[model samples]
Target chain A: MSALLLHALGIVLVTAAMTFVTRSAPFVLFGKKRGTPPIVLFLGTYLPPAILAMLVVYGLKDVRLLAYPYGLPELIGVATVVGLHVWKRNYLLSIFVGTAAYMVAVQWVFQGTL
Target chain B: MMKTVRAAFLTTLPVMTGYLAVGVAFGLLLQKSGYGVAWAALSSVLVYAGSMQFVLVGLLADGSGFVAVAMVTLFVNLRHFFYGLSFIDTFRAMGRRRPYMIFALTDETYSILCTAKPPEDVDGKAYFFWIALLDQSYWVAGSIAGSLAGSLIPFDMTGLGFAMTALFLVLLVEQWEAFRTHEPVFVGLASALGAVLVFGRGNLLLPALVTIVVVLLLMKKRLTREAYAPPTPPAPADGPEAGGAP
Candidate 1:
């Protein structure tokens, strides 16, 4: 329709195309062949945990440790999650409580200071 | 089909909560940036990557060039390359659905699929598809709601984004419990932390991933022995190892 809409569409298409490339790289590379290498299989087995751990870090990458709050909200939130998960072993409860705790910490406990 | 959908829904309940919050946030931001409901829906349906969608709002608002948009998307989503490696065989077995499965492999979907097992009666492929489909639906629905109600909803959502971090932490704990040896988990944490320190948070992921792959390769002999070792016995038929093995 309009120039802005067209431009936005272009941005969306480009972003989607690049994203698909990354997501499908492994499938395209290893999918055509019948048998995959043992090393690739090994990496597949072990890489999930590593990647999950990295994702956790990536999620918190924006936390400014040297600032006023000094990453306290995230630290407490993580502690809450780990403690609740280890103790109760409930997935939904751990995430809900941990996230709520982090919210309260950020929204009120550390409010203006951060 | 209904049974599989029901099971998938139950399994994705946690993600339902997480995605709706973040998706709505994305929608509100996009709406605030002058895009409307149609744009929000389009982005969620086409792009589907949560973090990247959030970044896209800023890029769209500033009218960034397509080259800039592509570069930013690649850098933001490069981590996804490793995600499909774990699922290559699993998705390959899904027949024609293989392409969509790969396309929908967001962080949340990838994590849940890694651990969540279908019920005894439901088909595994159907279960996987429903999970992916339902997760995306929640996102799309939330985006539309936020775009429409952007002006009406005035509540502060400052900390709601923490749900993602919480979800990841919970999954990490599950992964830690599932695997007998914790070396991979430790390797991930140490590598990421090292990369953060050395490369800073903004540019750490690529280096972190590289270190992790190299380190894992070096320890393959020992790690593989322990992973497939008969001493600890295998983790149940539906365990993480099941997907990796041919």
Candidate 2:
């Protein structure tokens, strides 16, 4: 209870500091300066996508070749989400359907063991 | 307007799943380490970096001093500094909410915002804003859920972490399907493989991230820009009298 508040305090402060550093450094230091090295600009521009793609791949590195030996439920759910994502290009829809599908498939078929 | 909202919401879906899974694990880790939900919620609201939050939990658990945490986190989040560079142009147009919007910027949010070139008829800034807001909201919700549900659920939430990986693959498929551009995908894979090869399992994120950035930077000139580069206007319809009058 009270402990939660204290813990949150540290978390909040750190979060704010990190956010401020990243978000404000450019505006503060540059102060609306015009010249940005093209290499820096280029790296900055593409870095987000590159970072995200890396994050995703890193996130999934643990997904097994087979769940429950076959791991069909998790595997199938992931496949379905990918399918929906490509078909609709809708992130929310795909996630919602994927989560629901994953949840449902795991519960009903695997008896929630997954 | 609705379309933009729809896109924002859609773009945030994966974010939501990733947040929930990661955020909950964070909550569990913190709680077991004697921290509380408040820390989880506030950090989610503030820091909002998925991997860093996990790292922070471990650091705190290790009882490292503040100076160590600060330095490590600074580097851990150093890439975010680069994220803002590209966003400068996009953020400037945001007007009043600029500061707050920038504060909420994360890799995932920035990725969504960066690719959004508002239709000629729409405001790109607004689209970026909504996307950022929506993504942050999903994060906030997940963080809160994780914090509040710390011990309420009995299942092993680590398995839930799979959601993040699964969601990433989904986004990858989505991007590849829509863009048909292999450059970004190739760079991402190369970086991941690079990290796996070099880092050898000691926090592959930093290496992979560096590889992606370095690779992308190296290849910037070769790739074409966005699809919305507004076609050049026809040369005054040839004045209807040049060579052959209408």
Q: Which one wins on TM-score?
A: 1
Instruction: Evaluate every candidate with DockQ and list the scores.
Output: 0.65, 0.36
Model 2 spans with C-alpha error above 4 angstroms: A1-15, A23-31, A66-75, A101-114, B1-11, B116-123, B154-163, B177-180, B224-246
lDDT of 2 at B182: 60
lDDT tens digits, residue span B39-152, model 1: 999989999999899899999988999999999999989988988877776777788887898999999998888777688888888888889999999999989988988557
Among all candidates shown, the one with the greatest DockQ: 1
Listed per prediction, chain B TM-scores read 0.89, 0.74
Model 1 chain B weakest lDDT span, ten residues long? B230-239
Cα-based lDDT at residue B221, candidate 1: 78
Tens-digit lDDT string for candidate 1 (A1-114): 999889989999999999999999888888889776666777888888888899899889999888879999999999999999999988889988999999899999998854
Residue B202 lDDT, candidate 1, scale 0-100: 76
True contacts kept of 1: 0.79
